[model samples]
Target: MKKILKACLLHSTAVSVSLLSFSFGVRAQTPQTPADEISPPVTDLLFGIERMMGSDSTLVETALEGFEEKYGDAVRGGDHIQGIAMTAGGQIVLSYSRQDPSKENCSGMLIYSSPFDPASPNRELDWDFYCETSNTDINNPPTGLGPEAHPSSLQASGNILAVGTHGGTRFYYLGPNGIEALHPNTAVLTGGRDSTGLTYNPVDRRFYLLNSDGSTAVGKNTIRLCRSDQDISLRQANQAIFTDSDCINIRDVYVSGQGANLIVQEDGTLFLVSTFSTRDLPDNLLGFADDNTDAIWGAYGTRCALETALLPGYGFRASFEDHIYISELDFSNRTADLVMKRDIRRTQAVQTCVDKRPAFRFAGGVATIRNGALLGLWSGRQNPPLLSLNDSYEFAFQDLPQPIKSASVSEEKAYLFRENNTYYRYTDSQGVDPGYPASTSRNWDFDVEGDDKEILGAVRYDNGHVYLFLEDGYYSRLEKDGSTSPGYPVKITDNNWPGLAPYAERIRAVINWGNGNIYFFLENRGPFGGTLLGDGEYVRYNIAKNRIDLGPRSIEGPWGILGDYDTDITAAVNWWNGKAYFFLEGGEYIRWDIDTDETAGPIRTSKYWPGVSDDEDITAAFRHQR
Candidate 1:
């Protein structure tokens, strides 16, 4: 029912989010693995030759042969390898699922030993699949139960693992001890179905979730959060939920400057940048006049800002902190906070540099990691935008041999991770994308991964590597130094992973909890199910142990994912002080204490703003600095 539909919209006399043309690729299907069959390793590799260089292919081939020799029998016997995670200690956990009839949304989990040492006591530990046996009815399933039990994302703080399951449920796995349900078994709070994206930032100790779905009568989306130490299940019946609805449909979410600021990309209109705190996630909405005199065009991928140095003459500087810089298709624009500060001619050079990318392809998104440094990616025909700011900022677009679908910005370099395609890394002292370079030690190809495609969700950059999750059901890791292994693609199904794949259609959501855990969402399309893997599946990739833990089945049907199909879930997680936070697609959000691994109370948000209708959508989330 949910077509590859981009919302069709038109703005009023003022500016609005335009439905820019999206380059659509055919969704080709690979040979399906029967319930008892295992997918060929070679079948999982190869999309572009760029990824098959020298030892990379050999590494993957060797790993595949080893897996087949020792584990191939078990895989063929039936094991659903879903998602992965890497821990701070370097333990990698691989999750697998198996089907069961005890519950409608049944699933399971298997913990792999540490990748650092398989002989270590932490080898693959097969645990009983945690099914959705909670006694809750669908029409009135308990708070966190229902067909939407697909565990969307997982976060670990201290020794506790906080599982943000489908249908707005928070399942807490207290490490060696056991599991505890954090939220109440009621539908009043978690907007019925599974909300989309969820993330937890370690530094901030708060969780963030984006709210989608048509529950609220008013249009526009809502963003919510929960603290790390409080018990989400003990909240009152009608407590005032903490949320910021000032922005419309939030498409993508990002937290950077180490929680000093938050950014949300709403459709193709505004890149809302704001500051986050324990109290509120407010965004300063600068009112635009009816006249077109002071209006700026909404660039789909870039953000716009005015130079702070030029704001003193205008009263706008008081309302604004530093000058804001937003990106445009042809050029970048800067507006002062106050009308008096509007000396556009003085800051014209800055604007010119912003638009000077060597390539003119559609700049899809921009991310700032350490400080003012940023990396920009293009959608398809567009070019990558690179900008480095010192005393005088510089902007340039480089032409890559291949088009980059999505990218993540890191401290010293920019990682261009693609889906169904090869991967590349570009380095510029100026922090700009160096159009596909001819020769740079910084080049590694991931095209060897099965049917390389532009990755849908945002790529995640953490520690020293970039994790590329493509739509072809494969996830690969590439080091910033330009080292990549052939796609060690893993498969997911009910037989292998019981709990998380009930609705197995949509498995694109991913978030990296800085401590080494990788959280992801999967779709569960009820008994009848949707497109084979269309239902959401919640997955985790343990980088430390090289194993997976898959379960916490969804009881409700599909409709539980957050972010646009291609939006990165990592952007939603915010780390502040000693906590981590994230928001779901349906407006339900939670937080975790990095120090305690405890969940604070759940935070609910109103579905619609005053002027918005239930039919509208959430485009993005950003912070309005205090």
Candidate 2:
């Protein structure tokens, strides 16, 4: 058995039932016919149970009376909705598990026409034509062999409808013309014991199925990929195979004997969620929520039924038992956080049974509509309701403890090195506090030092590592977490090459071009300091070879313009467009072309870039593309 980790929301609160109650109105009526003999209503009225009929006879009767009054005409005696799918055109396709099996026309699937206005009391459904079986001559009837066949899951893409049957190995596709068997008996990818979930990826033009034995054990569940050149015939061609070893453990969560569901976003990111775990397949293992009780006789025997929906902006919403959780997924970190959670039971007296335990069985499926509203289906004696939630977790940037000395940015996050050798990371949306502190080990002891170890510059390379240049002619390579790389603080002295020894202590500035080259500015501050020694030299540090090239002698030619400034080279930054700009002491700057090894200007910074003040001195500058 795999260990189950509880990943509940950081702050759990009660959802307001009053808002849902106002949307769903109850009706009064006593069913005169048997459940299986009744026909589905064609009106726009909201149907289905809102609350469960607990052991309390008085409460159950009162709830039943309200349902009878509002939806008595739409309620079928034994009609139990199993699955639902909504199309882009606003059409709703519903599957019933306990439809009248005797009716030759009872296909267990119904199609509700569009313009399903929740405010309208007289909405209409196409009750004459079912999804699986239609009386019309143009559409074909369901291809299943038995009348007992019931749909377990339903999914829609454009006008195509994909239906999975309970306890059946094959899935069915319903189109404008008719219904057909999606998988043949000889197909390579026969669904598991029961096909619980089905989804279509428009990008790849393929269908994905979640087949499992209902065990939350590793390797007991499988995700089958179905593909076909034609729209009608689907064949199992492959399984969701992961290249990552950590993702291999994801199959364990599906082993739990509960129905599982899948959702594929427009970006081809696949999400699989079961009662045991929610996984962003191929890598991330989003932990599970614990709502199970020790009592077997409780409203929900063990665990809560689980379902997930992909909201806009990459937000993931999960409905586990009686609580709804909203989480933001960080694909870079391979982790997700439960940002907000709402427990529906807190606001409803009808949520618990006579035993006072929450009855999760009364809850139904959750679907996200085009307008971003969540429609929930419930069963028992009350009417289902619509819930609208603001599930977005906006990132808030926190103030840094100290001013940033130098900063570098990666694809997913920004790194800020503070004046105290402490570093923090800023995501595209928010800033993080200080992480691992910078390393203290030095390659050589400083001769003139009084605890003021200034960080001269910092840069993030193309290879994802960061380098921090110190004032003492030494540098340290830092890991993404800000910790010093092993054997760091390498001295700038050319001990291995003998060429860099002369300018070792005279190194004044450094800048990483993001490519494989790190450019160093060496100034000859005569023995007494402040005395200019000709034009300072500029050298290119070969990052891969870990050696400085002395053959070029120095940056002569167009680069020799920097030699005029001598020690006045104040700051340098690799701009977003890939060019390096060197700022001089008098607010004058020059653009260096990394590719051609040329200089563009001795232009005044105040004239070209007004944001940079001439009198204002900058310690360091770096590129940050958030």
Candidate 3:
């Protein structure tokens, strides 16, 4: 009697069992059993054995032969599989690209009935989803192919399969019947370009597209998210609608690299892999190996096939050309390590010479199977093969470094100031960080010693100079090169400013107009607490002349001219529009024109700034020009 092996296949959607049971001698034939009958641990052990012996071993080979004989050859003699996806019900879907690009009926899809069972017979069905001849005219009734009609990427969720094309021109979805154009008559997503990558985010139940938009000229390519639950067919046409409100803008997250592929880990963390250039990696969320060269070859027009996969117990694995780089990510520390590397050429004969070099062309597609095994497809091979790696490798991570407390940007660089009075400048061109002045002394100028006074506030001027406000009415100036200006750390009273003599000790906030003047908000704690000084004083410094001009005046608000014991000024910021905004302790804000000294509003801050929480305190705010 043959030994019957029962196993369960756990997937994102539904669970199923393998019909072809493994046996030493004759293959054991059994009806499919419910997955619940087998415990998870036992199923895992069985799957582990299967993985060790390899999916294409004699057992699977016999099963494949039987399947072809029963169901017809679903592999289609090894057609080029452009995209692979698994449904929630344990069904596998493969999108095949046009073997002959010039032929109209070359692109189609194959639906496999038994997803996790390698022994399962041919695909359940195969259909032509892409008709290039009919799609040649994009504006016609039949819905012809646009410039981006060549499907290059695909993602599946539930019962829908989303197909993306090159040039980011068109998007389509394949349902049970056939393929249908998404937002068919709508102009909602017409503006984006280069739709090379697609993924379904289970956490938010939305579809994300990695592509570039109209702002690509300025390196603003980004990840765009579409609502998954929408009735896409009913969406209106000619509506230039797009969602960037929650979309991840590459410019904001990464300082330099343009995004190529995006992956959302099981834990909801999103990782974007870079392509083509040697741009600096992001310091948050995503991590990478330092040894991996940044010389990925894809650009807008050039199609460089790069792919990544999330390992079950390991971190992430990415493939480019003939090399595969595996990384271990420590999300807690926001770091990644390139733990291992492998050359695909050594395992398989994958070379088709285009020039003098072995053409690995279009060989970076990878997917994970239900049994925690990795499946990869290369341009040289039509069928996806299992990629084996050490499952017991360990990874270590370093603690994430704390970022600077505050930052201000200028035209050429961004200055990040820490609480320790040390500052670092990052050049925009190269994203390189140049450390602060010698650590031995606080002052960059050897002539003067830097003060240890905690920084109260800081502001940058248009001339590239920064002014630092400190405790006890002392201030310092830092030039663009991170060096102190001559005669630094001067006392506010000694700067020849008038009207601050009485309230200089109680200064609360400072604002730099960025032109040539700086303003100060001061509170007066007069003699005997409730005594006769004013509510507060507003002082101005003429930076060019190194003197105070029109200040030491009583702060006036809509409530009335502020009296000595009135509400105090809590926060203030220069809006960079020749106006300064001040917040009061009572939650109201008033705007003052720096040049005219005229005041407006005692209105609620929330009234002017939409989306701001009412309970949020206005601590600090600044604006930067793109």
Model 3 misplaced regions, further than 4 Å: 1-134, 137-149, 169-171, 185-195, 212-248, 251-262, 273-321, 324-360, 368-626
Roughly what TM-score does model 3 have, to 2 decimal places? 0.31
For model 2 the TM-score comes to 0.31
Clashes of 3: 9
TM-score of every model? Answer: 0.24, 0.31, 0.31
- The order of the candidates by TM-score, greatest first, is 2, 3, 1
Best by lDDT: 2
> Higher lDDT: candidate 1 or 3?
3
Worst 10 residues of 3 by lDDT: 391-400
Supply the TM-score for candidate 1. 0.24
All candidates: CA RMSD in angstroms? 30.0, 21.7, 24.4
In the range 1-626, model 3's lDDT, one tens digit per residue, is 00112232211221121112223344265432222111111112111211211111111111112222222222333233344444333344444433333434323333233433222222132222233323322222223432122233443433344444333424443343444444433322332433334444445444444444321111333434333232222111222223444233332322111113334444444443322211122122223344332222112112212211111111222222233333332333534444433333311112112111111232223333332222232222233222211111100000111111123245455433332333334353443242221011222322223234544556666666666665666667766655566787667665344444455566666667667777776665455675365466677878777666876666665224333224356556665667767666555678878777677877786576543333434433333323
lDDT of 2 at 46: 15
lDDT of 1 by residue, 206-267 (tens): 33333333111112223223222222211221222222331123222221110111122222
